[model samples]
Target: MRFELARLFLLERKQSDAFERRAADGSKLNREQWLREVFSQEIDFIHRKSERRFVPDQSRPKGEQRIVARIGRKTLSHENDPNDHLKEITREQWRACLVIIDPTSHDDGQKVAIETSSIVGSGFGNFESLITTINGHSPPEPFVIELHSITDQTTFWEYVDRHKGKITSIALEVVMPNMFGGSSSFEEDAKQLRDKEKARKIKETIENEDGLEPETERMRDAVSYATRGGGKVKAKAKGATPYDSTRDKKYIEADVDSENRDINQKTEAAIEAFNKDENEAVVEKEV
Candidate 1:
């Protein structure tokens, strides 16, 4: 069967080659026959060497497989560190390729397991150059391509006309690096700051209220005074102060532990005042 297939392929190639030779010799060409011969060769090649026929069992279940083509030294990392310097140095050294995924024959789901092909480029200019290269010199072997970002679909389709049949689908994901901290973290910090401010306002209201005993007033004043320097103390505690590490050790460090203790005490005292007022009202009603 293999021998027969090989012979059939050789015969088809000979026919196509003969048409080219005839046209080169200034002979009146049969256009339809020439087109048929060219198409026949392409179909024969696809049937024999296309990557669609060799997908593994494990990948079939997922309906798609993703393979990253490592074309540069810098790779996507878990830490999400900046790679601007590395990318700048290795800009010219980058290369790109295409990835093809062929669907399995046994899929029964509504979502048709699409065979996707992606052409990767290091950057926009490099990608355009890569597309031109593919147009001029189409590679035979299937490659795994990584698209760290999306390319213009129109531009891509223009160059990929040759291998359109092998590609059943195209899926491109644009992966942008998270340079700024995540939105969730920023929102959480804002919420915490708001809550702390609310707590500080409540403590101030309790300290300024009239009709308290002299000792109670003195206690409230002391708590308020203690918590007044909380901003600087909190900044130091969180290592946000520029002078935190550089300060001379001859002077004693400001006690952040005491600052936290004072804030907690003031918050508790405000809550206790509310509870005490409620208890007194209940006692008066009983009497």
Candidate 2:
């Protein structure tokens, strides 16, 4: 079955190649023959070779059909695999592929997985150029190309050439985001939370080491007071004195103390006056 399928793929590739050749030579080829050649079984051996080099190891369940294809670095997998008619696999296998790809990551490595629908929809070509570009620009070697589908290989190739020798083997796989089934994307979100936690810890460290808490509170209080006074605490006007030992810091402190003392005295006087008034009223009633 694999050999036959490989042949089918070869025949299809040949048709496309022949059409390209004809077009290059300015010859209008017959569409009927092109279509026939694309589906012919004569190139089974060649197709087998291509499949061995490109197709992934896939097995489908009974009564459920699927499709899988890898061109260069991009692996396109779908059911019937509607992403393309060239897929020849099972739905279960397809689902498994999604699981595998969904977990496969490019974290700190050359192996990166991206959403094919997003990339192609945004007008990017295939996996080759994308991988090559990442390999060239991103650090480390042996970058992997991962996508659900590739629309353009030529662009990928061009991008690859721009960054030569950096890229090694291309590992293509169809990575689909889990929708309703299992907890897949949950892992990524968890990772993000962990990162945020780490950041919060680092910030705490800085605050402790730099005495940020008290300093920040003081600054905030100063701003609040300035706001109450209806004036902005402008960056100490250009040439303002930074500090002065003889400056009356005592004046401000004394003013605050005096205000508190006056408030206390006023409260004591009011209490005494109220008591005296109540006593006089009681004495007059007795008389």
Best by lDDT: 2
List the candidates' TM-scores in order.
0.14, 0.13
Cα lDDT tens digits for candidate 2, 1-287: 00000000001121132224233356543423332222121111112122211232244223311222232222355545557675766542211111001111111111112222332221123333333343342222221222222122233333334434333222121122211122334334433443544211010111122212222343333322222211122221122222111111110001123445453343233333333433553575369
Q: Indicate the residue-level lDDT of 189 in model 1.
A: 40
Question: Which pairs clash in model 2?
Answer: 6-47, 7-44, 67-87, 78-81, 129-156
Error of 1 at 247 (Å): 52
Clashes of 1: 0
Residue 156 displacement in candidate 1 (angstroms): 20
In model 2, the worst 10-residue window by lDDT is 1-10
When summed lDDT is taken over every stretch of 10 residues in candidate 1, the lowest stretch is 1-10
| TM match of model 1 to true structure | 0.14
**Whole-model lDDT values for every prediction:** 0.23, 0.25
User: Highest TM-score, which number?
Assistant: 1
